[model samples]
Target: MPRIKDLRAYLDALAELGDVRTVDRLVDPHLEVGAIIRRSYETCAPAPLFTNIKGTAPGYRLLGAPGALSSAPGKPLARIALSLGLSADSTAREIIDALAAARTREQIQPVLVDTAPCKQNILLGDEATLDRFPTPLLHEGDGGAYVNTWGTIVARTPDGSFTNWSIARIMMIDGKHMTGLVLHPQHIAQVWQQWADLGEPMPFALVQGGEPALPFISGMPLPNGVEEGGYLGALLGEPLELVQCETVDLQVPASAEIVIEGHLSVERSGVEGPMGEFSGYQPHETSMQPVYTIEAITHRDDPIWPTVVEGEPVDEFHTATGLTLAAEALTQLRAAGLPITTAWEPFEGASHVLVVSVAADWRTALPGVSTGELTQRVNDVIVALRFENLVPRIFVLDDDVDASNVGELMWALATRVHPTGRRIVRTGVILPLLACYTPEQRHTATGDKVTYDALLPAAGKGREPRSSFRFLFPAEVQQQVLENWPN
Candidate 1:
């Protein structure tokens, strides 16, 4: 298998699998391009290649729904899988398992090279312009044009002991200025605050389009102090390559399609968002966030910029981050010694829910614990998990439930989960975008989290197994009927 090194190769891989659709007809970058990507995601249509974007330089192009789910019947996650260098038909479980295993290997530091394609054309200081590349107005309700939905921001500690690569939304504030959030407790913000305390602007670079792994590992919720470069190397079974930035002290992927190097002003702020968030809401959120002043721009000849339509589930946001979230959560649960067979974050949940399976025959969290105790232990750990902040509703299912199947998940929710007996409620930091929170609750930054236990109670008295049409007949009888049925 060829290792994914850049955006063009990944696009070629998508084309090879018959999952890419190109549009040579000019499309406006404002709402027209965003609507097409949105429709493509809602329908599980092919990834789009907008060859001609209106009001931009000829060489600029856009890759819509870059790693969104494929509509291919047997390979819905084909784009995501292929991006990770896995088989086109790889399952969510397989992808998660691979990521979990990769975390255990030794970190492979990225190699620094002197020259890179990203620097083929460099614009310094005043010459560098953010709008020159055509920032897309992703939604009509968006506060401004979004140019960083899928890009990775490079930031590290002042001493450079802990470097972080992360993905965050950025809104264009003219040619030299851009604004984006650094949510409290997130690594990027934590590091930026350190620089703020010292009264020094933090050097930074925004990278768009390099190893599909760039964004994948960037989004993984790994342990604090752990950099993504090593984990990404382990995931790809090779060292990541890097190149020094022209204007910033940090380095970016040598193969990146475009690099925007700048300094995040410590004393500056700008009104950043109100974008259609991943939680499917366009909240009335606009804040004075950190201002990134552009100092240099570099890119390969005719580069492709990637963007995601993030509002709803089954979109690029869900497809790229869903499986990774499940993988990280599953790893945490197993390490904590929970009896979780597997976990799945159904794309329909967006970033709000996680479904985990436990075997029907399994019982007890401790040697002599009661079923209630077992459930409590499981609930306690998940409710307090770091990622649980993003997940407010967790469904603990029996092994028979196909967590990946939306139909099965819905059936499990309907028949087993109840409003009272099986549900436990707790409060956590509820993101403002979740619809469950009223505007008041959203403003308060807290909301209720419900843990729904849909598993069979122990394996004893009054045990009622789930009812499914497939289980209506014995295995042998069903096989005979299928073999002898009239054509």
Candidate 2:
């Protein structure tokens, strides 16, 4: 299937697949829309399209759960798969493998255009107010109505050598002002610091409803200094159409539903967050972050704002990030000459645990290898690659066990991983959002990185797995039973 070029095209495809639900009735952006979207994620329902959002002008709409899992029978990853230009029924492993393969291809730069649909309606200076859009209060205890939950924030280094398209939650402080998370070492924060050092506000463009793959790549953990647009192009097998931002020097996806060109203040005066994050918990504390001043706003005739209520399991962050992180880890591990078969971050783990599938004959390749030695080897590679922090916990399972499936992963951990020496703990930089960390650990950004040797004993010793129907029954008998079963 051809890649979905724009948001509308993707939505139309979703409609055909019965994965999009259009809500025409009036819906409040405060909490009602968020509630529906959250419910959709929990129930694996179709993506919600709120056409009659309250307080927004005519033709303005809001799309919730844009990257959330689908409810289509046996096709939970359909939405994510479609976003990546794959078939609706593509499996998790296929999607991850595709993403990993794309990384090896040459970077396809974006094609700059003279004009785009986002320029159909332009508001400048005083008219460029965020209030014109129905930004939603996604969660009850959220600090404010977030305007850039699923949107990509476009920022470029002053030297123009690199451009970063990242997804950072931006909260609407007022009509013309917003605040967002810009943490250390992040591409955005790195560029922002350079601009701050030069005593100038960092130029930015918030792109909403761009090409279907925009958000997935934006949220991906690509290498430092890599332009997301080029990676997106490589993923799509063609260049992404782009248009220069009106106020900022950056270029945005030409067909974006909404583009807010602004200057991110160097001063960290604005308090941002306490919003519900992907960790499935809402931290009560807020932080001082950089402020964004909206200088210009552009959108399509009838724009659709894509919002991701970032909390709990199986949301956009879980589905998209899980696949992206897995692809990254897999690519890096394989490139380092590791005998890794596949890697996956199950949605049930909320991006906390990385399930790494090693080759079944790893012991044969390295005679009489101990679990601790293999665990150390993997840990060294992860630390050397600077991914130890991102992957807090890792479960090493044999390739025969499907790590993508939550049930299979749980079973492997429960049965294969012994309680004593199987668990390897190492101190390292840790993600603060993980619930396992305390306030002090989060404050210092230090914690234990755990790796569990969930692989079964060597040569299948001390284990019996001839229990399931597929394993117990002969192939002929199984085929006959399946053929005779009523549909």
Candidate 3:
């Protein structure tokens, strides 16, 4: 099948799979939209397409829980799989493997186009106002209506050596201004620092409702200096078409539904956050973040805005970021010469825990390496890659257990991991978003990460046969049972 070209195409595909709910009745953008999206994620329901949002112009629609987990039977990851151009029934392992495999392919640079659907209607200077669209207040205690939750914020270095497309929460300060949580170490902030050093405002293009894969790739933790557009092209097996922004020099997806052009202030000037984060926490404290001054706005006819309610598990942050992080981990571990077959970040873990599956033949490949030695090597590799912060807890299991399946991972942890000497804690940098950290640790960004070696005993010395249906039953009996399952 041809890859989905835009958000509309993705919605159509989702509708066909019974994964989209069109909310035609009037809905409030304040907390109603957020509550609905949150409910959808919690219940694994369909994506909500709000067609009649209160206080917004007619046809100015919003898509909530765009990348949230789907309720489709046997395809909980359907939304994520569909975003990657995979079948709705694709497994979690398939999605991760595809993302990781794309990293090995030749990067296909994006092709520039003169015009785009995003430029269908253009508003310049004071004419460009945020009130034209429905900016949803995604949480009850959110600072304001967030306008860029699921959008791609395009930024570049002052010298133009690196162009980064990332997703950061941007709240609407007014009709012409916004602010967000852009912090150090993130590529957006890194680029902003370069612009600050040059004494210039950082130009940004916030593109919303682009091709389905745009947000997925934008939210990824790709290596520094790697442009997301090219990586996206590589992932889709075709060059993504781009169009230059009206006010900024940055280029955006040609098929984008809406594009907001602006410049980030050289200095912090606005209070932002106190919004619910991916870790399902809503700290009452807010911080001063850089202000974004809007210069131009462009959108397709009856444009659709996409927003992700970030709190709790199984949301876009968990689905998209979790998969991408696992893919990155798999790639990094394999490149480091570890006998890793696959890796996964379960949604239940909320992108904090990484479960890595060791190759079944690791013992043969490593001669007589002890389990502890293997665990230490894996931990060292993770620390070396500086992924300790992103992955706070890690579980290492053998290939017999599918790491992507949370149930299997838990089973491995319960049955294989020793009561003592299996869990190792190492000091590392930690993000404050994690709820596990204490106030002091959150303030200092320093903490200990735990790694659990859940691998089975070496050479099957003390390993017992798994009593699961897949392993316990004879092949013929299993097939017969499956054939007669409906009976």
Candidate 4:
């Protein structure tokens, strides 16, 4: 992996690895650029750099599918690996292992610099025009071109000790202002509510492009009051250089391509949503979301706007956020002393599905444990106890199978999980995106969850040893087979 010091360095590295494609064709932000990027993500193609975008300045380029997976052989997880400072040859297990290791290592503080390339051009007040940049309208039915796709929002609590970094979509309402949807359940929205309750607008700074690690950290499932900057610094083995926003007190990455300084109005809200979400489905209704007043815009000479083409599985958002969430879940479960061996985010279904593989010893210890009992226990431990929302299904597998491999998991489910005996279902509100249950089943306070025990029983009464070939093979034969096979 190339050493990524800033956003520009990361872009250069992508280009060098043949993972970035620069297109000179003029594409419309209304949908053309977004459509192309979405297709690229589905095909696992290179990132599309739209240099000539309709209704935008010449130099302003939009980077689509920035962190989408790569098609290159031996580099399936390349996009995430690059973002996390890993080699393109890194595997999914390696990526998760590295992150888990970094979490335990010493924290690296950010190096503060007086001036950065992002400040090369500063637009404030009337001069700061969001329309000048090429913001892509991701979906055909989207309300407008969203400028906040894959962008990081930095906001500090009133007391200043707790800082939050998160990703939220922002639509350009006008030249100097925009409207952002802050879901009631999200931390950012909750913080906005707190400020609104106190009759104060929440100060915020939206960063377009910075170190890829910044966005990765923003999407992390860390505990409350944990600073994303500190997490990012620790992951990168260096401190992130930050600069104060022109209008807001919040500090942003000094090397960010574009920074929008603004505040969320407590007393005001406008119709927000109808934008395609990570679930690959559009919301049926638009709600009154918080309004953002953009006070300033700062950028480098030629900024590259990173974006995610949100739709279905295999999109940039799914691959990026899914891997991050899986790694986080594993780390959290281990930290909590859970007897989990592996965790995975299956790409076929929505991001809400998490498959956890555990040691057979742990599964056998809880004998006669019904599916409902196991589901309730696991759900309580993962969601109710950890407070990590959005997970609806937890499929537990034996240690022999890899949770990341859907095929192996499906095989286990087919042979081991009996519908009448092992299938578990707990109905309640868990994930809003789950199409299986109706709205009535969703519970805001404590949602319902299910766990499927896809493991074979060790022993059965009045039954022969269920085919030893299915469970184990001779160690000498396995070694011989592996040795005889050609690379």
Task: Show model 2 residue runs off by greater than 4 Å.
Answer: 460-463
- In model 1, the runs with Cα more than 4 Å from the true position are 364-367, 481-487
Q: How do the residues 1-487 of candidate 4 rate in per-residue lDDT, one tens digit apiece? A: 4447677787777776788888997787777888898899778888888889898887988888877777666687776788889888887678877877777777676666777888888998788888788867788777766888789998877877677888877887777778877765666876787888889999999998888777777776666666678778777777888887778887888879898887888865667766887777776656677788888889998788988868787775566567667777777767766566767777766677787766656646667765455545555566643325567777776677766677776776677666675655654435454554555554243456666766555545322343444346777776776789734
Prediction 3 TM-score vs. true: 0.97
My TM-score estimates for the predictions, one after another, are 0.95, 0.97, 0.97, 0.90
- RMSD in angstroms, candidate 4? 3.2
Cα deviation of 9, candidate 2, in Å? 0.7
Lowest lDDT sum, 10 consecutive residues, model 1, at 364-373
Candidate 3: tens digits of C-alpha lDDT, residues 120-239: 899998889998799888898898988888999999898889999998889999999999988766789899998888889999999999889988888788887778989888989999
Model 1 score (lDDT): 0.83
Runs of candidate 3 with Cα error greater than 4 angstroms are: 483-487
Q: Among all windows of ten consecutive residues in candidate 2, which has the lowest summed lDDT?
A: 457-466
lDDT of each: 0.83, 0.87, 0.87, 0.74
lDDT string, candidate 1, 2-27, tens digits: 78788898888888777889989999
Better of 1 and 2 by TM-score: 2
What's model 4's TM-score?
0.90
